[model samples]
Target: MELSQNKRVADMNYFELIAWLGIGSSHPGGFPATKQNLAVLQILPDEYVLDAGCGSGLTACYLAKTIGCKVMGIDINSQMIEKARTRAEKEGVSHLVEFNIANVYDLPFPDNKFDIVIGESITVFLDKVKVYREFFRVLKPEGRIADLEMALLKELPVNLRHQMEDCFGAGTNPLSFEEWHNCLAEAGFQDVEIKNPQALKDNGNIVMNELKKDWVLIKDLTNKIKRQPTLLPRLQKNAGFMKRNRSYFGFGLIYGRKPTPVKLGFKDWVRQVIFRKKTNSSK
Candidate 1:
């Protein structure tokens, strides 16, 4: 995707900047954290997975390659979807992984279509319950959701909150771990829990560390920074804020499962039938 030369990187929002740079892992804790969460998911080969907000298709392709699961990845950004498709093709996972441009709130799939739904660093920037409910809608009975997101480890002061919005974007709200768990539960999920929770670590070179593993992306990012010199400073500003206020933030896997439908035995079914008949007759 060709970024507009007229648009300054300074003016681009956080998502746009990352998309333009083609950064594979922009979430808190980066790709290592993703690997940790994947260990906990224990995905099966036959399961169908949905990678919600899958930027550049890193995690989606990884799932297809590592676990042999069929994955459908969705992103709101066209550039992200395009890059993701390219990554899938390059990584030889194109047969098992697919990418599409779609909104998380209104997924294009039918209800109960996916065995698992995964998200990273996306829900923090949107309505958590609304997104979780949509995820719940598309998940099959007993399906799982594993969302990796930034969480508030402590109360954020009013000034820091404002600064956070300035650095990321408006409406960037990271909830406490308890609140994250409750959101999934409110969305009709069972066994909701925040797994592998930990406070933020200020690895000063997080972006470099992740990108160094992908030399192709590193070259692309270098070209991007060359084209838009303002990009680095803008990224650094956000990084600085995170490092300075790292104490107030943390991240983890917000995991949950859709409830399985109750099965009725023969006697219970007979009682229900008789009760329904009586109630109908009375009416």
Candidate 2:
């Protein structure tokens, strides 16, 4: 899958291509897994949810329809936000879901604003620690955060690792299964559960099937190429890379609970002050 001579993979990132393609459920397990995660969330109709990287807003609409809850979706990509807004309108859940162009690192909402936060394969493309911290800050006490993210089954060779990182785009440095757990723990999440790790090597077939169901997949992709002809070659190159290095990558679904704030009793406060004094003395 050689790209045209004039275009390089560096010219366009993989996420831009996905945004242009307008693919829904653009993760490893697709929508089925998305539905499963939503089901287990046990959402109450009265609760408010955040879809952190709601690409096309499919999950947002689904959440609204399934639980009749309010869903606010935020994405950094303006183009994706526009498409997501249109999808929400089309699904007749525009009133139930709001789409905004916003960064995950600094969410526009105030602290403790949401009952639940959900993301699908989004954390892999950001500063995971910072983004998780933001997710933690915005969630109410005992609120849950759930995500489906890419994970490396094993370490790749140095050259292969560099190549994959460069080509995968949007900071797509996937963590190992254990690393993800530690990341969540460090971000102030307790009871972290990383589960259902699946091999991504043969998952291209799943992605293709989902895209095939979209009658306008080619149409949207062609429109993207017309707008920026150089993107075609870069997209082809990404495809080639994925086909070649699929074996090293996989996906994981994660869930974590934000601990409820506890009131400190006299003994607990004394212990904390002593601990703080000892920490400062050591420093």
Candidate 3:
């Protein structure tokens, strides 16, 4: 199908947007808590961190309060950034964290400023190539990026795949392993580690135990959407193309670092998921 205008987070409610955006992140460990989500990515108390596509900044704020470290969070939507900042301040982490309204491709910082960068299911919403290059430019050498984003295992059943393909359109990006590697390599990240953070892990059952109610709701909704199919996409406000490919998509995850002294698991593949970053320099 043809790609046109990009989709916005407001295409749906904040919570629902986050839900759809975080594919394959079954939160094995409960939503944010279930997967330990960003929490699993430990932080150093004195290091400076950048959080790209910080959404509500829950992870950013938590990073600051938990580590007492300096963190700068940025996102394209001004309103979301504002809400994130307010929450940070209310939680008393504002002293160590700052939120900004900006796009991932045009970060406002000097090169090599952040010790670590994170995108908690945020990269799926950005232009992967340009954003990865930007991250390479702004991060401190050897800095790591962690994210829980949707990855591709393989194509789902055609009907499901096509339905998803239509509903998401260009908004949905599915990448093979090789494609992901080339992109990261071209962007200058070495020792890249791209594997299923939850691969074959039965943690989904544990997660389902918690979100069971939501699971039932989503399943019922899923079946309901399949029947009409167009209904959910329309309700989600997806345009024509997105609605056309609603079911043609699936998800998984990725993580990597800037040129670091580590093992190289190099390979050629198409990539879909991404993790974004920010720095100490204020916008």
Top-lDDT structure, candidate number: 1
Model 2 per-residue lDDT tens digits across residues 35-94: 877777789999999999888788888899888999999987777787788877877888
Ten consecutive residues with minimal summed lDDT in candidate 1? 207-216
User: TM-score for each prediction?
Assistant: 0.91, 0.84, 0.62
Cα lDDT for residue 146, model 1?
99
lDDT of 2 at 270: 100
lDDT of 3 by residue, 139-238 (tens): 8878876655555445556575555445444455655555666666677777776544443232323223332443223444454445444444454443
The global Cα lDDT (0 to 1) of model 2 is 0.79
Strongest candidate by TM-score = 1
The TM-score measured for candidate 2 stands at 0.84
